[model samples]
Target: MPYDLKHVFASLPQMERGQSKVISGDPKGNNFLYTNGKCVIIRNIENPQIADVYTEHVHPVQVAKYAPSGFYIASGDSTGKVRIWDTTQKEHILKFEYQPLSGKVMDISWTEDSKRLAVVGDGREKFASVFLWDTGSSVGELTGHSKHINSVDIRQKRPYRIATASDDTTAGFFEGPPFKFKFTIREHNQFINCVRFSPDGTHFATAGADGQIFLYDGTKGELVRALGGEKAHSGGIYSISWSPDSSQLISASGDRTVKLWDVGSGSAVTTFSMGSGVNDQQLGCLWQNDHLLSVSLSGNINYLDKNQPTKPLRVIKGHTKSIHCLTVHKGDGRSYIYSGSSDGNITRWDSDLGLTECFSGKGHTNQVSSMCVNESEELVTCSMDDTVRFTATGGQEYSGDVVKMDSQPKSVSASGALTLAVCIGQIVLLKDKRKVFSSDSLDFEPEVGALQPGGAVAAVGDAEGKIHLYSVHGSSLAPEGPLLEARGKLTALGFSPDGAFLAALDDQKVLTVFTVADNYSVKGHFYGHHAKPVTLCWSPDSEHIATGGMDMNVIVWDVNDEDKRIKMPDCHRLHHVSGLAWIDAHTLVTTSHDSTVKQWTLTY
Candidate 1:
């Protein structure tokens, strides 16, 4: 176990969230954007990125606030989905799906006692609600808004007062059990995007699309004074966060800038501008102690300290895992990728920022056979446990039930949003179900070894010397299908570049090509390689095919010329090849069962 890894790129800072940005559903809340798609949620300043990633909304529409106890977080999304989860384990303890009309969820706030959460979003029947986190029970009602509610704040040391802002150009103050609307102040002409109460519960502030910032007395809910006028922000203000000392407030805006305001005097203290470009539109901001964190739509998370202005301390990248069989989304990303190991752990990688987050928060019971990304971006991984489990992008776990499989999964592929898993010898299709594809008998007893996708054709190779090719009529695999038969157990199969031919490699070290259609006619047989072939891959252009064999050599074949097969020199190669993939015409990637994945710069 000599330090297992062969090579590593850079040593990433082990922050709490592993380089994922946490975006707010409300465009006005502070969006924590990281370059690599990793983020940590922290408060009080010393360790802002150490807090666990707690929630994810459908459209990322609202702000998530940590309860006073720091044990739970209340999060809301654009679809009116609100979830409260535990902080330590990051488990979903409560879920509220309010259905009616979906509007942007602007903000969520926790009461002083950490018992009730005030949730505000765009809705027709209601604009906001006060709910108990433990049981999903309603505690109070939301009132006094003629239009969409934009922000909410509850006094932590309260006389139990709540404040909110709205697009209807007003801020509302309320009092509770059946929290009734107390007062409404019509002051701004534009949408109010953010409102927050100070830590001492003495005062509050509101910022809006009108480029106005106002201060109010938290206890009486009286307008203290206007901090800035139309000249305050060049564009609409999106988010505001209070500093830990309750002395400063930071605001982010579409103007591509972040402003730190002195709360007491109602004046601008300092300004941090990224640029005037549209890509730098600051959608959200947060004061994590001594540092300010802001997010832009272009996926840039800016970290600015009160003292330093030159460089960001760190940046995270993220890519969502492309839905696959037997995979779980671990951290977070916009683009998705999937990684499978022989031991069965399948980690989802966010391609948006190029970071690999753990697949599932919960450990897999067995080797993962296949995985798929559902329409909801939830990763579903099927393992030998005869079960399928669903995990979110942040590694949040959902209860998984066992699916009775006739045998272990051999090959699995997902198309048209459905997962097709071939286990033992049966081909089963599952759509939003774990047990939907289990069958007593369906096809030849063969273990699926390879899967190839091209146009309307999907090819699956099994252990029993058979290749099943089916036409995709709609979503279902054509009932009448069996594209071709191979000479030996089909170890590898792939479609040629133009979809004109199919290639299959057997354990007997033979490569065979056949026409994709017309009864799958044999095109040619190319023999003369190692004693055994293990893996095969085609370049991005499909002009070249590369194969790795047990003889520990990589052979590059000229697909256009059968007479010229080039065996690249292995004088520089040392590892036993287990996996092969061509990255580009001039680059290749390979992995070995010896626990190593390597990239090679092709000379030819």
Candidate 2:
């Protein structure tokens, strides 16, 4: 068996209502990066499909910047901790870690030599810190702004200089080897949001909430001119990205537009409207080679085409929220992974090719609680919106029949054409989206369920840590025998591929396996998971089982050998595993709240 990672489907940059999310592109113009939870995601500039995630941070990361040399990356988190790591290797080994501020570290900048770093953020005493990259030795002070700093950048040329944007409506400039505060420019009537030096270090620009872009000489920090003659953007400017030649720049704004500006001419060359919705507001921008990119408040990354200003060249879309459920459906010799996030968005991923295509029509309005592939090769999903939706296995739109669930659905399972959904107060059984049997007044509260592959048996777990077996009668279920009880409240349950065994997990952190052939007799009680395991799938050979838990660990248990198991600890950093599915007996896919889906090869 081969259990190593093959590919990662990275999450979209995390977005908030008013916060400006910072995105940085590498100097080499090959990759761009942003933060989602504790990880910094780096993806190819041209092919956004190829990505890598740095998960060494223990706190929620705010920003990540690639070194000028493109060999190292410095990322900062909510706790004001900055971690410098190697980007050339797969492990991303830690090079250095420093606590730059007492509060959140909002931004980081590296000098052209990559020998020094300046970090700025909200802190109790000082809002910024400047130190040597090799050692934490202090090199200078950033003390002009009274309020917390929002952005910072270091000049790339010889006469080293640093600039900072602040909530105080001012832009501060400094010169360094041992950086020292030079002067503060208070031309903006509103808060300054971003500042950046040109690639050639000949000039620098600052954009602010006042809707203005002020250009200045890089060496002397003298105000050169302001773009647009009036204001750069109609709404507050949030970010600016300088072109490689330092001759032009682009700014993203809350006005739902991105503008390309000629620095030397001080004129707007082109303007692109993102969309009218509030979520379409441009929050971040990047200029890499011929590709100009902007991040909308909705978390979609847009590729701006200078020749066609009205329409984007392409739009990269994915979930920006925590994923909660996932399942794998294999058909036509290809495996498709379906994932549902907390926001009700559903995406289908190709396991072998590492590709994704989101559904086209309107689907769930709220979080999708559970999903399974039914016998007729349709995806059956239940959600918090009080409805069930079905999508064709290979189609891009909803096939039209939407089943209105009687109550809040907690879990769902399907076997061929038969499906069983456990609602908060009801258990509804359906065939092809048509409700066949439903009972809202069960004696025990149904928590989770699993339907046998042959659609002959059903296992319903309740809050009392009991697994109730039922025989599939024409359209209804009949109790089979004594309940299989465990030590804690049952959380999840599944039947083995061969229909010979059944597995149930409870809050007590115990996984109890029972033999279906022996009147549901105890088969094994595995107890290695330190936390409640919510996701489980059996191998094709039915000899091994993989479980993912709230402890951020993925454990593969050997059924025949009680002492043998493989554990992958901290599988997705601070996020818990949302679900798991087997691509093959030797391959497994795990999705998590981190908004990432990972493919792992099992080695035996």
Give each model's clash number. 48, 10
lDDT of each: 0.59, 0.89
Candidate 1 has a TM-score of 0.51
Q: Can you give the lDDT of residue 311 in candidate 1?
A: 48
Estimate the overall C-alpha local distance difference test score of candidate 1. Answer: 0.59
TM-score to native of every candidate shown: 0.51, 0.94
Model 1 Cα shift for residue 125 (angstroms): 2.6
| Residue-level error in angstroms, candidate 1, position 594 | 29
Question: Tens digit of lDDT per residue, candidate 1, span 382-429?
Answer: 677665555554443443533456666655544334556666666666
Lowest lDDT 10-residue stretch of candidate 2: 1-10
lDDT of 1 at 410: 56
Candidate 1 residue spans exceeding 4 A from truth: 1-63, 90-104, 308-604
Using lDDT as the measure, the top candidate is 2
- Write one digit per residue (lDDT tens) for candidate 2, span 1-604: 3368887888999997667789998878899999988889999988888999888888899999999899999999998899999999989999999998998998899989998999999999799999998898999998988899999999998889999999999989998778888889888999898999999999999999989999999999999999998889999999999998899999999999999999989999999989888989998999999989999998989999888888999888778888888888988888988999989898888887666778876788899888988877888899999887778987888768788887898888888878888898788888867899997768998999999989998889999988888888989988888878977898888888898889888888888888888988888889888888888888888888888889999989998777888888877876888788887888888889989998888887
